[model samples]
Every structure is written in C-alpha cells, then in structure tokens.
Target: MAKTQKGDKALHSLFAGATAGAIEAFITYPTEFVKTRSQFGGKKEGPIAIIRETVKTKGFGGLYSGCTALVVGNSVKAGVRFLTYDYFKRKLSDSEGKLSAPRSLLAGLGAGMTEAVIAVTPSETIKTKLIDDAKRPNPQYRGLIHGTVQIVKQEGIAGIYRGLFPVMMRQGANSAVRFTTYATLKQVVQGTARPGQPLPSAITFGIGGIAGLVTVYTTMPLDVVKTRMQSLSARAQYRNSFHCAYRIFTEEGLLKFWAGTTPRLTRLVLSGGIVFTVYENIMKVIGNSGEETS
Candidate 1:
C-alpha cells in the first residue's frame, strides 16, 4: 500500500512503520531467535529442539537472547522501508495515483535495499553474534551496547556489517516479493471499494500472511546464506554470500539451505499479519487512509 496521501508528511510513515515493527518484533522475537539458531549451519536441530535446548541451558528468557537489537533495528528498518517506499512509489506511480505491479516491485526493491544498508546490516551482525555468544561456555559481551563495542573494537566498523551483500540481496528480493504480493492482493481485496476505503483488518492480515508465506519459500536460500554470512566466524569461514551458499550446499546438502524454515515461516507469517494490521490501523487513527499518493 502507498501508506500516505500526496500531502502526508514523511514523519507519519516513520511513526506508523516504527510502531508496527516494534510490535511485531516483540511478539515474534522468540520465533526469530529460534530461527537464527536453526540457521547457524551445521546445526541439524529442529526449531522445537533448539527451543528446548536453549530453555534447558539458559531458561525461557534465553529465547529472547538477542531481541533488543532486533527490536530497535526492525523499528528503524521498518520506518526506512515505508518512508522510502512512499518516496519511490510516488515517483513511479501514475498521475492517477495508480502503481503498476512492476513499479511496486521496483519500489519495494529500493526500499529493502535502503533499509538493509542503513539499519539491517549492522544490527543483524550484532544480533547474530549475541545469539551465538549465548551458546558459548564463555560469553564475550555483557549486553547490546557492550557487544557492539566489542565487535567494532575487534574487527572495526565493518565487523557489524559483515554480511552486507547477502543482506542487501536477501532484503531486496524479500521486499520485492512481499510488497508486490501484498499490494496485488490488497487491490484484489479492495476491488471496487472507494479509493479511501480500508479493508477489514482480518482481510488485511490474511493478505499479509499469504505474502509472507510466499516470500519464505522463495527466499529461504538467500536467508540461510545471509545468516551464515553474518555470523561471528563469517570472515574466516566464508568469503562472501556465494561462498557461504557453496559451503552449505557442498557440506550440508540442498536441504540445509532451508534450515530454520519452520521457525522463520512461523515468524514471517505472523510478522506480516501483525505489521500490516498494526500499520493500517495506526494510520487510520492518525487521520490517513494510507492511500497511494498521486
């Protein structure tokens, strides 16, 4: 969706998007944690097993090991995504405020890339390392700030952006798939509705869920590689995203590329539903129908 009318200020998109992302991140964080652990490559553990093991060793709170960074990052990332999408969609849309699917895909790609570079890369590096640290006998960092400092001190600023390429690729494709799917479905669902009329929350959630489900299957390999490339050992283990994928394929077989699918699938579906529903409702309350700006 365009998320704002032509005259809407950029701050509206930022607040609404950040709120939605923070809500989704907190709600779905456990699944996210489990998903990361499962994606650690060479780990054959299923989501349930990972959860059980984490809880056994570190208690239930362990499932939220690296959540603080993600919540903050996701909030900023979501804000950047919506803001950038609104900006690009305005440029790409027709004079009648109609955006073609192709244009929507391009806009989404641009938004994803922006967010990946500005927010995701560094935050993800820290989050992944924190989760890995939790599994160690001797944890290196005390918290998010300390961990970030430690990483920067040890490896320079580049350390916190270890998987930049894969992150960009994965996020670009991910948003392209998701925004296209969601926008297309929203059009279908809103067929014949007045331009400003909003779909029911249930319908919006369903559409978002479907979008996420499709994205999960299509982008699983990229996500797997992204995870591996962001790990603390990524520099020594793999040279780049391609090398990471090659290693996973040759060492662990094709199925390994789908590692963490179940938890990720769960998280994304729920995340989609939560994010869109919250964003739309919040936008409505803020006096915007979130219509595409002409």
Candidate 2:
C-alpha cells in the first residue's frame, strides 16, 4: 500500500508539472512575445504598444510565435523538475522521517540543476530566434524547425547549444531560488494558519508568484545574454557564452543588460503563481487519493 501510494504521488507530480507548463505557456505567451521584442533594444515601446503592434502587424497568432517550443521544452523541463524534486523530497523524508523545508530546498536545487542541462539550451535557441526576428531583418531561419536545422547544419550539433552555459546558469539558479523560496514561503504561510489546517490557496499562490518574480528578476541579465547568443548565426560575432556576455556588458550598459525585465517579471509572477497553485492542488488530490487507497 505504501509503495502504491508513493507511485501514485510520483505520477501525480509528473502530470501536475506537465499540465502546469502547458497551461502557463498559453497564459503567458503574449507577455513572452513582448519581452522578446523588448530584448532587441530598438524602439522603446511600452508593453501595450508592443503588444498592439505585434497583434496588428503579426496577428494574434504572432503572440504565440514560439509557443510550440515553449510547450514542449517547458513540459519536459517541468516534468523533470517536479519528478526530481519529489524524488529528492521522498528520499530525504524517508531518511529523516519527516519532510523538512531545507530538504525541499535541496530537492528543488538538484532538480533545477538537472533541468538546466536537459531543457534550457534548445528552448532558448528557438525562443530567441522567434523573439529577435521581430526586431531585426530576416536572418533566413523561418521557424523552430528551420532555425534548429540551420544551426545544426552550419555549426553542427554544438551550434544548438550556443548559449548553453549561461542558460544552465540562469535556469539552474532560477529553479533553485524559485523552489526554495516557494517551499519556505509556503511553510511560513501555512504556519500562520490555525493548527492542523492547511494554508489557503491564495497564500500558496501568492508565495509562488513572489518566488517566480524573484527568480526571474534575479536571473534576467543571464537570460538576456543567453537569448542574444542563441539568436546569433554561426557566422555572427560573439563566439561563445562568455564572449556574448562580455560584449553585451561592454557595448550595452548594465541597465541594458536587464532590458525587457518588466514584462518578463510580470509574466513570471502571474504564470508562476497559477502554475504552482494548479500543480500543488493536483498533487494534493493525488496524495489524498493515495492515502485513501492505502
């Protein structure tokens, strides 16, 4: 019975992560479009203006330009993140005989670090092309597949991983901070509630939102550089991740490094909140059912 319950929990966590990633993709697609456009650093249009222009010129479908990649990449990323997190949590809990906040933080860090290698590079490559195209002249890559093929052909498999190091850095740190903060916040919020009672959905969601905001903002500079490097062609300047970061910092001021942060942060908070909330609820349901079966 305990084994069955554990299996169920694992399955539920996977489902929750996948579902959350998919749903968040749709919910935050437009903001992503806006953020991408802003990253190019051309015309300083407000969020509303950028969104309006994108819709008017590109159509509503344009807002979801890189959504396919986002869905696929994020689904895998989230699946790994949650599964590994759960795995770590369960392992730690079993050893310690309790689920501790520090354990959850460690689990999230490990899961996040793992996902950085698995998902960030390819996803950033595709997304950066889509976003960068909005501002620059046509660089020849049509869409996700074309861009991927072009990179592979031109630079070989290594091309696809142009900004991999920074991506790993950004995503790894983001995940660790996000999950750790979320666990800490959830515990803090839950503790405020009456004894034997769970935290309210609002509190949980709020904490998740805050966590996402912190993570995104903290890592926005790395994200900006990652996008720029990935968007470049094989022949383009900025040879590698370090060179890309150096060039961006040298050419553009420090503030420029954080361009498009507003929309990105906004998207992160809202999407992160909703996704985490939904994920937690789904996990709860699965956990409860497992408890029942046991």
Candidate 3:
C-alpha cells in the first residue's frame, strides 16, 4: 500500500533516520547515563538524586560520559531502523494503501532485530561502560576511542556485544512498539486535519513522544537486563539474556526489572519526539528537492 519508495526516496528515509537518531541521542545522553546506572538497582538514589550526585562528584561532564557512543550508535541504529522498516513495510503492505497492525509490528520487529544484530549492541555496550564506570576516580578507560579500543582488546569484540540478546529483545520490541504507535498516532491525527493538509509539527512531535513513552513502559524490563549485562560489575552475574532475566525476576521480583523506567521514559519520549519530527522534516525537504530535480 505504500507509495513507490526507491532511489532517492529510500536514501532520504535512511538519511532522515540517521539525522533523527543522532539528534535524539544528543538531546538525551545525560538522562541515558542515569537510566543505565539506575538499571543496576543497587543504588538508592532516584534519577534526580543520581544526577545531583554525579554532578557533585564528577561534574556535569559525568552526565555526558557516553555521549560520543550514544550519538554514533544511535545514528547507525536509527538509520538502519527506518531504512529497513520502510522497505519491509512496503513489502508487507496490502493493496489498499493500508497496513495492518500485525504487519506493522512485524516490520518494526524486523527493523529492531536488524539494528540490534549490527549497530545497537556494540555502541550501547561502550556507552553503558562509560556511564557505569564514570564514578571511578581512576577510570581505566579514558574517552570514547580509548574506551572502545580497550574493551575490544581486553574482552575481544564479543565484549562489545556482551548483552546482544537482551539488546535485541529490548530494541526489537521497542521498534515494534514505536513504529506501530507512531503510525497509528499519525493516522489518527491526520484524520482530524483538513484534507490535503499536513498535521501540525507540534501534533506530530506529541505523537512521537507519546509513542516513545509507550515503548519505554513496555520494554523497560529488557532494557534493565541489557544494561546490567553490558556494565562491568561483579553484581551482573549471568550467563545469557535468559539467565539474567531469570535472576532479576526471581531475586528482585517484577518491579525491580523496571528500575530505570523514569529516566528511560524521559529520554525516549523526547528522543522519539525529536526523531520523528526531524525525520519528517528532512523527508519533506528531500522529497521537494527530488520533485524539483525531476
């Protein structure tokens, strides 16, 4: 049901997606750090409390410890996501210019799983370590390059993907929720708008933010497990994603699994808002340019 999407159109989607992801990561890095640490669940501090402590102990820079990795990883992750999602969605769509929820869900799942296998794991692993290790007075890894290189050297490339399955689970579910919710929200909003007129940017962003919050609430347990698996700590004792999940569920109960819900929600809500908004705007520009050229 989707329109013809190839050549410049697909490229536009990928570029827009990359731009969106980079912007989202940049805007949310600090909160992301807090979210990562919060997932550890050993600390009694809440989000704000943790932020205050980090600033006091490590300065504002502490909040942005994983920024480089966030930006790079998210750029690749989001770009790949939109690119793949659009392709798969077009492939799976019906002839009536409509997409069923299940198909959309599948498209999202495909997008997430693909990104997890490629970009998300390694980048997020580095980001997690940077945030989790920032508290050390003499942190072993210094910055993004040094940290990444060291992780690879010390633990091999496998270390960078330490929490691959959990990451996949979280991201795959996240994409599924995100695309479906955003698509649904967009359709709902457009239904109210004047025919042939676009939805307002504010409305679009609001939809994205709400969709992000939904995804966060739904996938937070996997996110917590992912963070724990990535972080270099003794407390994170587990053999695999299932093992980690079982441990958290059995030992910490269900509530503990959603430990970093607050910061994660905040980051993702804003990230989603920014990602969709920016992507749409960029696509608009690209489309206009392509038409004029044609």
Question: Each candidate: how many clashes?
Answer: 0, 0, 0
Q: After superposition, how far is residue 65 of candidate 1 from its true place, in Å?
A: 0.5
Model 3 has an lDDT value of 0.83
TM-score for each model: 0.95, 0.87, 0.93
lDDT of 2 by residue, 189-294 (tens): 5566644466556866788799988888788988787777776552377777787778777877788778888899989998778778778777677664211100
Q: Give the TM-score of candidate 3.
A: 0.93
Candidate order by decreasing TM-score:
1, 3, 2
Scored by CA lDDT, what does every candidate get?
0.87, 0.73, 0.83
**After superposing candidate 2, which stretches have Cα over 4 Å from the reference?**
1-4, 41-46, 92-104, 134-143, 233-235, 288-294
Positional deviation of 163 in candidate 3, in angstroms?
0.7
lDDT of 3 by residue, 230-275 (tens): 9897234787778888888998898988888888889989988888
Question: Which residue runs does candidate 1 get wrong by more than 4 Å?
Answer: 1-8, 192-196, 292-294
Clashing pairs in 3: none
lDDT of 2: 0.73
Name model 3 segments beyond 4 Å from true.
1-5, 234-236, 288-294
Worst 10 residues of 1 by lDDT: 1-10
